[model samples]
Structures are given as structure tokens and as C-alpha cells.
Target: MEAAIKFEAHEEVVSFDQEGNVVVNKESHMSKKLMARRAIEAHRERKRLESELEDYYFEEM
Candidate 1:
């Protein structure tokens, strides 16, 4: 047997199997936003690291 739950606040639907394992119906909006934010943060960190390395290389010259 399967059971489903809906969150009215976020309008997200979640399901569960008889064994109590969560089953995702679809990608949630919040998750998409979170992923985007994380991607942006990662890109910024990469750029910062690159800049620091370049500065250090120039200083050593």
C-alpha cells in the first residue's frame, strides 16, 4: 500500500510506501531555488580561490 501527503503551504506533494520510505512525486520549488543558490555560491568560491592563487603567484614573482 502507498500513502500520500500534501503540504498546502508550499503546494508540494510527497508520497510514502508501506515500508515508510519517502517517494518524491516531483521536484519541489524550494529545492530548485536552493540548488540555484548553492550553484551561485560555488561559482563565487571558485572565483575567489582563483583570484587568491593569482595574487599569491604574482607576489612570489
Candidate 2:
């Protein structure tokens, strides 16, 4: 079977499998600056959660 998929002009078509799965290209969608910002935000959130957990653990001791 053949299928046609339409996307925006800025969108990149990575690949389509026989199982009807559409794979998007990450590199084309995410810029280095955006990726760095996301990484930093994730790291900060992780650190905050870890600190909270540590504080709770110490308080319970």
C-alpha cells in the first residue's frame, strides 16, 4: 500500500515504515541553542528534585 503524508514547508520527512509509523528528524526540528537550553532546564529540575528528596530524607532521620 502507498500513503501520502503532507506536512508544513519547514517540516522534514525522515522515514516511514511498513507498519505505518512516521519518524521525524530531530536534528532538523531542534537547534543546538534550543537543545542546550532544554538540557540545562532538565538538569536544573533534576537537581532541584534531588535536593528536595535529600532534605526529606534527612528530616525523616
Candidate 3:
């Protein structure tokens, strides 16, 4: 019988080397952390611009 594995959010057991480096499998797709960071930074920048625009227009006008 083959063992079964469960995948949680952002969890994929593709492969890892003994040195803890991620192993890439051409057959499998994996999630990456860079996308998350870029998303967060973009959200923050948007919020900052919106706040600044609101303050400038309402306060100056």
C-alpha cells in the first residue's frame, strides 16, 4: 500500500535536498513566497497613496 499525504495551505511536498535547498520537479508546480511579498507591498503602497490623496484634497481645498 502507498502512503497518503495531506496538503494544507501553501504546503506541497515536492522535494528537498539534504542541505535544505528546495528541489525543483519539472512535473510538479510549487508555490513561492515572492508573490506574497509583492502583493503585500503593493497593497501598502496603494493604501498610502489613497490616504495621501484624501488628506491633500480635503485639507487644501
- All candidates' lDDT scores? 0.58, 0.59, 0.54
Task: Candidate 1: count the clashes.
Answer: 0
lDDT against true structure, model 2: 0.59
Pairs of residues at least 3 apart in sequence or in different chains that clash in candidate 1: none
Let me know the TM-score candidate 3 reaches against the reference structure.
0.47
Query: How good is model 1 by TM-score?
Result: 0.52
Looking at model 1, report the run of 10 residues with the lowest lDDT sum. 1-10
Task: Give model 2's TM-score versus the native structure.
Answer: 0.53
Off by over 4 Å in 1: 1-30
Per residue, candidate 1 scores C-alpha lDDT tens digits across 20-53 of 4444535655576655565566556666997999
Whose lDDT is higher: candidate 1's or candidate 3's? 1
| Candidate number with the higher TM-score (2 or 3) | 2
Rank ordering of all candidates by lDDT, starting from the highest: 2, 1, 3
